[model samples]
Target: VLEEIGIIFRDDAEALALWKEAGADVKGERVHFPKGLCRSLLKTAPSIYTQHARNPDRSVQIGGNATVFAPVYGPPFVRDLDGNRRYATIEDFQNFVKLAYMAPSIHHSGGTVCEPVDVPVNKRHLDMIYAHIRYSDKPFMGSVTAPERAEDTVAMAKLVFGDDFVENNTVLTSLINANSPMVFDETMLGALKVYSRHNQACIVTPFILAGAMSPVTVAGTLTQVLAEVLAGASFTQLIRPGAPVLFGTFASSISMQSGAPTFGTPEPSLVSYGAAQLARRLGLPFRTGGSLCASKIPDAQAAYESANTLNSTILAGTNFVLHSAGWLEGGLASCYEKFMMDIDQLGMQQKFCEGVDLSENGQAMDAIRQVGPGSHYLGCDHTQANFQTAFYRSNIADNNSYEQWLAEGEKTAPQRANELARRWLESYEAPHLDPAIDEALKEFIAKKKGSMPDAFT
Candidate 1:
């Protein structure tokens, strides 16, 4: 299909040719991969890799049996207290960063949790990176809006980790989305080139809203996803050998009735599973799935949809899960309550991933023998010893008696989540950064902003 109808690549023709020359068959503007070419090129890609955080303890191992969770990406509006949905501001962005930092389940402070509409489009990435640097100790994604912004991200990292450290280490991992049905735009390519050249990691994702950007069938969608990611990942290798890259898939089926995109659907989950299999076959870390929902609010619909998607993500063996929280209305809005609810759900998923321990202690043969025949274990020695760590407890869930719940005003899950979000924000403290490095980052941002006129587009 790629050879016959060829993917549209809206970028430098010379660079395109270079990619084609590197084992891909070229016909005019289109490049096709021979049957075994993709697999051959992907052999050099690592099956697993480590993403380093500024705090060594916060570093994460991606791929293999490990999974890393990152928060929502590219939501333009934010829903907050007073139940208002408004254009996200810099303040809102910072608050989300704080929430991500506070939530132990979120491993990476994701890129563009919500567009900071108050900040100029050209300069917002600086503020966003600064927020991640100052507010969170976890690994975070770099800006991919432009190559220059990606360079700014690297420069900021240098200020934080020192010049020598960033030169030899992978400090920032970024998202580079392919225009689905096989097109890669210049902006994304530019950012990918920058990250690859600088030794930073990039998740080469195909942004496929099936039936819109791709074919309606799951098999066709997976084929397109595979082809796109293979081409993108190959291009990264051409840029710089041994560049850390992930094979990423961002796909959702469209609602035929309303001409809208739907998330957390069965079809997308299947596609994600196939995508993970393909990524593993290619010997690259895979990125897919999240706490996705189409609900406008954090209600029953949101809970069920998000749970379905989250469970599919864990089972699919996705290495890096983006948009793992705060997604609502099919990624158009970032709901605060939904963010907290997703974190609570992520905690549960983490426990599930721990799997059943087969150790003697885990078997608890003695405890069972002592209890025997449905006799109470609540008062047994084992129960008393392990009570604190025995069961997974939710911070935001209400598990009280009906009368106790009534006494506490009978707040719903969303209400309780909202309260928890507020408390987290109230108790948030900025993580420490070196005084000189902080000042250097501020100066660099100020100088860069001053160099360019504010451009909203």
Candidate 2:
């Protein structure tokens, strides 16, 4: 279908020509790839790549059986402790950044965790990048809203990692979504051009919400996703061969009755599994699946749906998991309670991914012998040595008996999560940065903001 019907490369003659010169059949704005061409171009892509963080210990390896978790992206509203859903402000964004930094399981400080609507559209990217740089030492994403914003991200990154280091290393990875049903918009393509030229990484994802952006059937959606990502990845390689990139899919289904987008469904899981297999075949890092749900709040529906998606992501062997936490109401709101709940669940998922240990120590034969067949092993030497680290413990879950629970406030999981969120913010301390570099970053942002009039859109 990609060759026969072709895909649209909207308003990007350079990309269209690049595809044509690289063996794709160009018909006006649409470029059709010949059989095996995409696979051949993808052969140069690295199976795994390192994304460096300011704190060297925090750097992450993407692909090759590794799974990295990042928080939610592109939500505009936030649900606070008082259960009020309102437009997210800079303060809300900073708070989310602090929470993400405090969470040990979350490895990447994701871009646009919630859009700061109060900030001017043109300048919010600066604040977002600053938050990630100052508040956390983890690897982060760059802006893709515009080509200029992407350049700004690179400039800001230069201050953090030095210009020479930024040019030589992959310090930032960004999301470059394809307009579904075989279209690549100018804004996204422009951002892709900037990032790929700078040797920064891009996640070429097809934002497919089934029965809307794509066909209702899993097979049909999967085919479209593959074709879309192939084209985007091919474009990245065209800009700079060997530039780091990820084959990404953000597929979800829609409700038949309400026309509402549904997540954590069976179809998305199937697509995620198939997408991972395809990505591995193409020799590129894969990114997909998350703690996705359509729940309005952090309730039973949210927990069940989030668990389903999280498990599917691990089983699919996803490399970089975006929207790993704090997604609610079809990506409209970021909930504090859900963020904490997802972090706790992330700890469990990490344990699950560790698999089983068959070593002699893991067998615990000595402990069994010491306890004997009929005796308890609770006080055995092995148990005593390993009890503290043997199993995964949730920081927010209640373990008290019914009487003890009643004696204390009868707090639910959400309530506990809310308390933990508050504590994280209260205890957060910004990571230190070199004084000269910090001043340079501030100067850069101020200069850029001064040059442009406030753009609210």
Candidate 3:
């Protein structure tokens, strides 16, 4: 269907020209890929690649068995610690960056944890990119809202990583979402071109809400997903062969009754599983799934839904998991408590991915022998030795007895998470950026901001 019907490259002449030059059939803005063209082009895209962080210890491997968890992306509203929901500001954005940085289980500092509405729409990208650079040393993403914003992200990165390093290494992994139903608009295409030309990673994602943006059936949705991803990821190779790209998909089922999007459903999980296999067949990194929920608050409904989605994500062998933490209200709001709760689960997921242990200590032969049949192993030497590291302790859960819980004011999980978020932010410290590089970044941002009038829209 892709080869015959073709995908529309709406209003992107440069993209159309490139497609035409690459032997694709270009009719106005629609480009048709030959049956095997996309697959052949994908050969240059590396099956696995490392994304370098400013702090070398925090760098992450993007493919293979590794699964890197990132916080939520593109939420405009924030459910604050005080339980009030409002438009996110740069301060709120920085706070979430700090929380993500402090989260040991969160491997990547996600892009736009929440949209900073207080910052000018035209200039917020600078603040967002800088927040990741200054507040966290983890691998981070770049702007894809506009080509110029993407350029600014690259420029800021060059200041820290050096121009030569930026040109050669995979330092940034930006998201480029397809405008679904088989369309790639100019905004996304331009950003993909800029990032690919510089040898940075771009996750070519097709955002699909089943029954709306895509077919309702999982098999049908997966077909559209593979076609969109093949076309987009292969295009990166066309821009600059060997530029890293991931086969990304964001899927959710919509309520057939009201058309509202739903999360943590079986159909989306099935779509994720199928998409992961398709990505592997193409030898590209797979990106999908998240701790997604549709609940307005961090309640029981949120917990159940997020757990289902997060489990599916890890089981799918996803290479990069976006929205792994802090998502709430169907991706409309980023709740502080939910962010804390999600990371608590992420810690457990990380341990779960390690699989069963067969070592001498893991087998616990000593503990078993010391406590024969009816006796407990609570005070055994082996138990004492390994107790601390034996289990994944959750920071959010109140596992104490009912009496103890009541004595402690009957605090709920969200209450505990709220406290944790506050403590993390209060104790947050900025990562060390060289004074010269910091100054250069500030100058670049200032100059760029001065060049354009502030546009809120």
Best by lDDT: 3
lDDT of 3 at 431: 84
RMSD of 2: 1.0
Write one digit per residue (lDDT tens) for candidate 3, span 1-457.
6799889989988888888998999988888988899999999999999999999999999998899999999999999999999999999999999999999999999899999999999999999999999989999999999998999999899999999999999999999999998999989999999999999999999999999999999999999999999899999999999999999999999999999999988999999999999998889999999999999999999999999999999999999999999899999999999999999999999999899999998898988998999999889999899899999999998889999999999999999999999888888888888889889989999999999999999
State in Å the error of residue 194, model 3.
0.3
Per-residue lDDT, model 1, residue 331, is 93
How many residue pairs of model 1 clash at the backbone? 0
Which residue runs does candidate 1 get wrong by more than 4 Å?
A: 23-28
Provide the TM-score for each candidate, comma-separated: 0.97, 0.98, 0.99
**Native-structure RMSD, model 3:** 0.9
* Native-referenced Cα lDDT, model 1: 0.88
Q: Kindly list the per-residue Cα lDDT of model 1 for residues 89-152, writing each as its tens digit.
A: 9999999999999988898888899999999999999999999989999999999998899999
lDDT of 2 at 371: 93
Could you tell me how far off, in angstroms, the CA of residue 237 lies in candidate 3 after the best superposition? 0.5
